[model samples]
Target: MTEDFINYYRENISKKSQIIKGVNDFLVWGKSQKINFAICTNKMESLAKNFLKKLILLSFLIILQVLIPLNIENQIQDI
Candidate 1:
């Protein structure tokens, strides 16, 4: 079941935007309800932290991609 969930996420929801949005929504809902959240993955703490950092970076990149044209075209014009 764990593998299946991971596979489904990899195949259908690999985009960082999706991951970030899902996590963000969950956190917001949890906070509103005063619910504490904890991650229980089998992954090591370092690995999990790295994964989360990557997701955050990807989400930030996606946001920049959308906003750069309007706000910083001069900086990223080469790309």
Candidate 2:
């Protein structure tokens, strides 16, 4: 499933997906209203950036965050 998703993202996302209606306008409006905006994704950092780049929205975006999980044991250190 992961491979299929990755393959589809690479092969089709840039070529096929359409932005939802009013999306850019919404973002702009949000900014005008002093509302912060962000793009959050579970995908790898590179993939997320590439997606924004493909959408031609990278330059307009303020920030995007990708949440990657780390091993629980690595999350903290006990002395």
Candidate 3:
């Protein structure tokens, strides 16, 4: 279930996640070019923000988009 995966992500996956090679350079290049970057994810807003923050990439993004249905949002909120 969603809750199980979320729990697992929090406990095991988040800390181990790695930034892709060149992402920082790419973001830097994009910034120099006056391009804006955003993260569009199925993850909850807080989770997505935390993940990005953990990777030190949160500052590169101007927007964080969490695309989840109302029911899933409610379920995540409840948990």
Candidate 4:
């Protein structure tokens, strides 16, 4: 059931996703300032990464975190 929802969202809803205003510019500025960013989402990691990639903001992140096998502590340590 969860997989089905994820697949449906990926195909039907994700295509309509939009980047918020000034987000790209902010990311560019943040990168230049040496501020690493991380994304924490309930969404699947792959899906979240794909979403960020589509917005051209993936490169600005130091890590992407989802509730997976790895705990949040481990995820943060990886940064």
Best by the TM-score measure: 3
- In model 3, which residue pairs have backbone atoms overlapping below 3 Å? none
Candidate 4 pairs with clashing backbones: none
Query: Which ten contiguous residues of candidate 3 have the minimum total lDDT?
Result: 7-16
Tens-place lDDT per residue, model 3, 1-79, is: 8889887776564665787899889999998898889889987777787778888889888888889999888767934
Per residue, candidate 2 scores C-alpha lDDT tens digits across 1-79 of: 6556666676665676667999888877877888776788766666677778888677666778767666522442211
Worst 10 residues of 1 by lDDT: 58-67
Q: Where does model 3 exceed 4 Å of error?
A: 1-8
Q: What is the C-alpha lDDT of each candidate?
A: 0.44, 0.68, 0.81, 0.73
Q: For residues 8-54, could you state the per-residue lDDT of candidate 1 as single tens digits?
A: 55444425444534767766676677765545444323334455565
> How well does each candidate superpose onto the true structure, as a TM-score?
0.38, 0.60, 0.78, 0.71
Off by over 4 Å in 1: 1-17, 20-23, 56-79
lDDT of model 4, residue 73: 38
Poorest stretch of ten by lDDT in candidate 2: 70-79
Model 3 local distance difference test score: 0.81
Clash totals for all candidate models: 0, 0, 0, 0
Residue-by-residue lDDT tens digits, candidate 4, 4-79: 6667766664577788899889889999999999988876666777778776878999988776555643443322
RMSD of model 3, in Å?
A: 2.3
List clashing residue pairs in candidate 2.
none
